[model samples]
Target: MHHWKPPPPLSLSLRSCRFVLSFTPAPAMSASSSSEVAPTGPADAIYRDRILSSKLYFDVPPSKVPVIYSSSYDIAFFGIEKLHPFDSSKWGRICQFLIKEGFLDKKQTVEPLEASNDDLLVVHSESYLSSLKSSLNVAIIIEVPPVSLLPNCLVQNKVLYPFRKQVGGSILAAKLAKERGWAINIGGGFHHCSAEKGGGFCAYADISLCIQFAFVLLNISRVMIIDLDAHQGNGHEIDFSNDRRVYILDMYNAGIYPFDFEAKRYIDQKVELASGTKTKEYLDKLDEALEVARNNFNPELVVYNAGTDILDGDPLGRLKISPDGVTTRDEKVFRFARERNIPLLMLTSGGYMKSSARVIADSIINLSKKNLIALDSPLGRK
Candidate 1:
């Protein structure tokens, strides 16, 4: 396994917390299990049964496009969401912009169901799920102080409910991509949360859950995660650390949040960027990284964590990439997958600025213009 050497220490900021992570290999699956055996492990059986019984994977009619979103995906709790830097309503705005611009028809967009307790259990442990019932734990995970004071029931209904809806979107996106070649979840990419832990404003392991569901339902074995979010995607990295079926290509500002040196060891291909890196250098590195990733792994599916946080002027990302750079980046990734005929699913991961919605909508428009993704087909036209 490839290991990343930690960079020299730098001046610390409020958002940048440095931590050394110890690498521990997860326990291996038993050798007694073979293709001939019915795969009888209790843990494996529970996970498989949960996935097979999930309502998140319901069939969408031919009239609807593969773009997944729901009005319930937006979180607003007595205006307390304003306390956090994240734009809680960004998901809704992205879809609104696309509809107003004629790039998409509102009637054709698919609305996803909220992920239930059983669905979450496929990736999250029972204890971890129980921990979320504490309003204090949830507030800490989401980084909103006011949320801790609210009753656990209210918090669950208002805040975590929206996130669970987004999780459903992410999981469903994989299935849609398999059937349609490409799909996008307007929200999701909680890359900071894992099966047993939640941090960095991420409460659930959506990426990990999505891939797990894909492995079971889509009949896909090899998967690649192309996480271009500004922050390191430690959540999925940690979850898939011992699992060889997933290949991770993570490129992010190394100086940013969740500076997990341990999780860095899990990345199949790690591309670290410095603070305030400009657009030209960012795009150049991505081009090369994609080339190397192509040469290295042949995957049945590609999960692209397209975070707009890398946009210029974003306070959180600390990178200086421009709006057009974001568009070009998405285009390049789409082209890469399209050319290879590989199924791809994109998640709008993290971007705190309000303008993130516009940039994302524009990028989707650009993709449509380039014929990289079809927003509407004659058969699906409304």
Candidate 2:
């Protein structure tokens, strides 16, 4: 195996950078124009009111770019994270690479607020939120056995707190995307956890919460979830199963974890890849799938769960897609949304390997090179 190291920080020159101003406004829909009725029941009323009153969707100035992250998003608890297969610090590492490469300005990157309990209740059940109070439940959900032995207070501070912060980032990203045409939340896409349950290292249903907020606050009637993670995004699948307003296109390894047969039924477009699937086959399927999805549903917004677990050496994903393939995959997805003039919010979901952070950082740089995403800062150039 090749040893991985953080790339040396690049000294950049502003003259070498390219700038093109392009903005696509979201499709207009009045806030009061929903075909759905207002909430009648107590539970629905509370949820609706919480969403309406939440400050998570605060305005982001145009001067700042639409990449959302926070230092709190990285989880570390005295080496307990090392017990799991996942690289818990990958979120911070991704940002570090981008900053070191001069692709991003640390000050310009938007830091999101932590999702309060009321904000989380927008999608998660009260019982589900309460269950997280126990370290054992959180441990089981995150697949970290030693976490169970840790005190609940430590777990809450070290683990779930970071997740809540990321959840806030995911929720805010939709609002940013609608305004900016595209946004990326560096630390979200917890797609294995639904409103009622958490599993597969995903403790919160950020995708569901994001879409829900978009539907209500952004005046977005239709949304598409393009989950290209190596594992099935059963959490969001189950959340939006009966909702016609949401269309799901999930391309994942069929033989992998969370092989949820039930969630399979909810995918509008399911591209299941076998173990050892190559880059060509994967990209080919994604191309065809995107075409089909475009013909099937015209969405106002697109939620892309851009997971890097499909990287060749990722043990969990079991796919042979190269680093270049990952970049190409993201580019295609961005192009698809750009062509449609639809706003897109991308979340960095799964991929536990140490190299995952570099791969993701490289992919974002590739997107910038292709002009699919614009890093507006002058610091990152050449």
Candidate 3:
């Protein structure tokens, strides 16, 4: 286990102090059962039962487009959201652009239900969920130090609620994709959170949960995760590490956060980019990576984590990709899935800049223009 040093006494807030005082070691798991998908056993039966009984996989009306979102997906408090570099209202802004430009009607967008504790239990441990009760743990996961001072109730209502709603959207996107050729969740892609851990602004393992639900309810055996976020998707990588059913194609700036060496070992295809990688170089690597992924395994569902952080001049991502480059990147992934007749779901993940919303909305518009996706109503009007 990696050793961690405690902070100085003065820096430890009330929440952090409580968390530190109550901290305990996690129970070790056998190597065989470490993976989220272990061999058939009693635990497997429980997972299946929980998934089968979940309300998150409900059917959507044909009138509504498969663009999952909710107002609750955007978090806004007394400006506490500004503490982190992330634009907490990015999801709402993406929809606003689409609406203002008449590309999509707000009523046509599907609003997802909040993922309940039972739903979260399918991927997250009970202890992990309990740990979130301490605002300090959540603050650390989201990388906002001031959040440690807020009451847990306020944190849950103002912060975690939005994330849970997005988690719901991610899980539901898979089902929508299965039904409608392709779907997009306006918010989701918490790829840095695993079942037992949350970090890098990812408090829930939505990607992992989405695939797990698809495996059980959608009757699909194989999944491919095309994570284009500038950061490594270590959460899902670790969850599906030992499971042969999931294939991961991760392209990220290696000089970023969550430099998890152990998680890197689980990636089936890893394309590491430097800090200043440009649009052409990034796309070229993606083309090669997609070709390699195509030859490696056939997936029933493709989960695309289309993060706009790669756009040039982003402080966190540090990559030099252009806005148009992001559009082309999305087109490539959608075309890849369309060509193979595989259902695809795209999750807007990891991009934090204020311009991310405009760029994402533009990409969706481009996808519509390219005939790769249908944004209009009646279920099939491109």
Best by TM-score: 1
For residue 139, give model 2's deviation from the true position in Å: 0.8
Which candidate number maximizes lDDT? 1
Candidate 1, 183-278: lDDT as tens digits: 999999999888888987789999999988887788676789999999889899888777667789999988767776667777888888998999
For each candidate, the alpha-carbon lDDT, in order, equals: 0.85, 0.83, 0.83
The CA-based lDDT of model 1 is what?
Answer: 0.85
Q: Cα miss at 150, model 1 (Å)?
A: 0.5
**Residue 23 accuracy (lDDT) in model 2:** 14
Candidates ranked, most accurate by lDDT first: 1, 3, 2
Please provide, for model 2 over 106-220, each residue's C-alpha lDDT reduced to its tens digit, 9 standing for 90 to 100. 8899999999999888877779899999999998888778899999999999999999999999999999888888899998999988888788889988999998888778866
Between candidates 1 and 2, the one scoring higher on TM-score is 1
Instruction: Give me the runs in candidate 2 sitting further than 4 Å from their true place.
Output: 1-37, 377-382
Error of 1 at 208 (Å): 0.4
TM-score to native of every candidate shown: 0.91, 0.89, 0.90
